[model samples]
Target: MASILITGGAGFIGTNFVRHWRRAHPNDEILVLDALTYAGNAANLDGLDQVRLVVGDIGDTELVRQILRNHDISTVVHFAAESHVDRSISGPAAFIETNVVGTHSLLMAAKAEWLDRGSGRPHRFHHVSTDEVYGSLGPDDPAFSETTTYSPNSPYSASKAGSDHLVRAYHHTYGLDTTISNCSNNYGPYQYPEKLIPLFLLNCLRGIALPIYGDGMNVRDWLHVDDHCQGIEKVIANGRSGEVYNIGGGQELTNIAVIDAICTALDRAFVDTPSLAQRFPAAPAANGQPSASLKSYVTDRQGHDRRYAINASKISNELGYAPRRDFAAGFAETLAWYLENGDWWSALLDKAQR
Candidate 1:
């Protein structure tokens, strides 16, 4: 069985992938390395069997080297990074240090262990990235393909783009077996509340105003975390070396559309429980309405991309990777998960406040 090192395994997509990988390959050993930043929650990975967690910075070369050599890790799924765009705009240094420097450190360590120290066995280093690296698109522009020119708009996307280049450099310069997947926006369980979906969901539950930035016309391709993980698995298993794949859910929706969807789901959820409205008395109202009426317009984020859509045909045709989750159905299920697991997300918010 192969030992796989999943960096940032405690974060949203990383945690989902760990759970997915555990079920799909029960015998394969998994090692998680996370620094447990504000976005990382250990509880997201709780109750899983046979997976080891190592809390540490990915930039620590010695620590990364030890883990690679000691664990006999043959696969590295690099996910650790400061990924929030707003945060990156307010403070780009953390993004550079973690996304760029940390990725470089991990790449060097992996190269040392897999290529220099041991016999050159076939190993994999899969870099998980975002479609924002391709920059914004106009209304009539085609979806971003693997060949899309890199024009990262925000600092977070720029940092990720830098890391993507590093991975490519390692593959070409040193023959390190590597692959990359640039996915669209991911929304599902265990996602940090700062993101749009979960953030609006929590606001709807707590009876607070769902703040929509600017006119809320910015568009994003939403991919469920589970579907994204499946694509990652397919890429790792069958993807050609030194290749890049685009993974998308094929569901494009504006930010306002996403919020409206969540509001509708919340209305259904609270249909029978009128008393729930009593709990969140402070929920703002618009034009004398209630709940979803609480949607308030806010200033737009700086450097916000106008639109991001992914053309996943490369992965679909080459590796037979297709997203299995339908947006409406999967989104409802995701809302249900948050509704049932209130304590899980509540505890995370509590910790963040502390």
Candidate 2:
């Protein structure tokens, strides 16, 4: 059994991956290192045994080195980053510090433990990245492939691109066994509500306006967090070193289309179950009104990409990776999770206010 270090293991996609990894490989030791920032929560990782969480930043190279040495960690799954585009625009420095500098620190420690120590032990460093690094695509442009050129538009994407380059550099210059996977947008349970889907879902329950940026025609490929984790597992288990793979859900839709889908789901739930009306009394559907009424157009995000789609054929052909969840079933399950676990997300809202 291998001991693995999971950076940002308490965040949305990271937490889901931790849960997924545990189930798939029960004997592996998991060391989770996280800064517990606004987006990362300890509760997200609650109820897992044989998993130790260290509250710290990845920028602390020494801390990571010790974890690698002490735990005998053979794999590092990097998921930490300042990922929100709006936050990055308002404060780009933090993005650079965390996404770029922090990633470098992790690479440094991985190199030290596996290479500098002269142990030359088998190690894998898998960097998780976003497809935004490829920049905006025209509505009819082909999906982003592994060979897509880097043309980041936003601060967040730029920082991630920088980190991606660092990972590739480390592999070529230092011979560190590293792989990278760029994935599409992910949504599932335990996701921080600041993201579009969960945030809008919460608003639907509270009778608040669903804010749609600009014309809301922006297109994105939506990947279920579980499917993304499965793709990552394939990459870790069978991917070639120094190669990049793209993971996608095969579901592309406009921003307005997504909101409309959510509205339709909520309306159905309220109709099928009367108790939902009592639980979420403020919901438009609960009060005999259409949920679509809550949609409100707002200012567009600066440098927002018009479209992003991933050509996942590389991973699919190489490692037999394919997303299993269809958008309708996946979304219905997501809505059910949010509806049943109001307390989970409510706590986040309450704390954010404080």
Task: Compare the candidates by TM-score and give the number of the best one.
Answer: 2
Clash list (residue pairs), candidate 2: none
What is candidate 2's lDDT per residue for 1-354, written digit by digit as tens?
A: 889999999999999999999999999999999999999999988899789999999999999999999989999999999899999999999999999999999999999999999997899999999999999999899999999999999999999999999999999999999999999999999999999999999999899999999999999999999999999999999999999999999999999999999988889989999999999899999899999999999999999899999999999999999899988878988999999889989999999999
For each candidate, the alpha-carbon lDDT, in order, equals 0.91, 0.95
Worst 10 residues of 1 by lDDT: 280-289
Per-residue lDDT over 1-354 for candidate 1, one digit per residue giving the tens place of the 0 to 100 score: 889999999999999999999999999999999999999888888899889999999999999999998988989999898999999999999999999999999999999999998667779999999999999999999999999999999999999999999999999999999999999999998999999999998887666788889999999999999999999999999999999999999999999999988887777666655554564444332112445787999999898899999999999999999888879988988987987787888898798889
Q: What stretches of model 1 exceed 4 Å from their correct place?
A: 272-289
What TM-score does structure 2 among the candidates reach? 0.99
